[model samples]
Target: MSRTVSFTQMKDGTREEYELLRDLEKPFLRLTADRVLEELRRQEHVTLEGYKVTRLEHGLQSATRAERDGADIDWVVAALLHDIGDGLAPQNHDRMSAEVIRPFVRWDVAWVVEHHGIFQMLYYAHHYGWDRNARDRFRDHPCFDSCAAFCERWDQASFDPDYDSLPLSHFEPMVREVFGRPAYAPEVIREGHVSPLGA
Candidate 1:
């Protein structure tokens, strides 16, 4: 059997125990892409009750759109994962999905993914007696326009079963490349930079 930490509480862990854990965590950290892929694959059957396409198809379509539009890796990966949290957090899936890609993608990409849900309200919120322009509250934020464009160009328009979305295999390498980066790397996050979503 492999060695295990002996601490009953995290604070009581000795340096050696913590070191051992850090060593053991390397493989788990490297396997994050696999776990993300697994979660995405699970969405194949986790359809929203009324959508014509499954969640996986919607994501594949969005990513395909981004790729065909000549978006960079960060944008493409963010597009693919922007709705990944739908299965577990339908009401706040935007934020959940953002968190999934935040560590690997740029700040602007993460911001757009996080807020696309609000921006998307422009499409159907008014029919529900809600303010369609609710997203206007963030109009002055740096990523506001990008978020709006993301909803308009990718997220909201991706539900068609007839769309020729690329298969998950096409994006698997991009997913692995992004997730394979060192978590929270400053160069990867670019915390305050707002790169354009366009090609």
Candidate 2:
């Protein structure tokens, strides 16, 4: 399998546009039988996909959804690589996010990737009742409990139902992957804004 996908081919095939959008997201998001499987190397960690979560699948899904949602290139790329840190340790991914994204992307990428788990602190602490040690560790993380404002910013981002149901504003764009061209023409960007909540 190749690290690259023929994103253009997927977007233009003879299918309902929305369906094509979703179809493009399938292989990496569900990598068990992906065309790119051969490209992945075996690792010690177990991930949602055979490849580490950060390698490609989650990155692709986040970037793809981000573009459909109308986020900027930085935001989409942020979404794509946000979990890159998770490749190291799924439990505390932000630290790794900061490390990996900082090198390849930008400070913004490091910021968002670092904070993806910020909102989860409360989720894990209050309802899940993680032990004091675990809770303390989570709370101490730089992104822990800080995403409310970050989330607010992205909460205002636009989404396109024709391409995807997820909001894109919440993340940094990942235009690098599709920089040469787009999977689709970004018709939703042309049509007009759609609410992240409904669309």
Judged by TM-score, which candidate is best?
A: 1
Q: What lDDT score goes with residue 84 in model 2? A: 53
lDDT (tens digit, per residue) of candidate 2 on 77-153? 55555555555577887777556434444343455567656543533455666542343454554433334433333
Q: Name the weakest run of 10 consecutive residues (lDDT summed) in model 2.
A: 35-44
Off by over 4 Å in 2: 1-56, 130-146, 149-199
Q: For candidate 1, give the lDDT of residue 67.
A: 86
Number of backbone-clashing residue pairs for each candidate, in the order shown? 0, 14
lDDT string, candidate 1, 19-123, tens digits: 889999998999999999998899888776899999899999999998888889999999999999888899999999999998889989999999999999999
* CA-lDDT, candidates in order: 0.91, 0.44
Candidate 1 local accuracy as lDDT? 0.91
Hey, what RMSD does candidate 1 come out at? 1.4
Poorly placed runs, candidate 1 (over 4 Å): none
RMSD of 2: 15.7
Q: Each model's TM-score, in the order given?
A: 0.96, 0.41
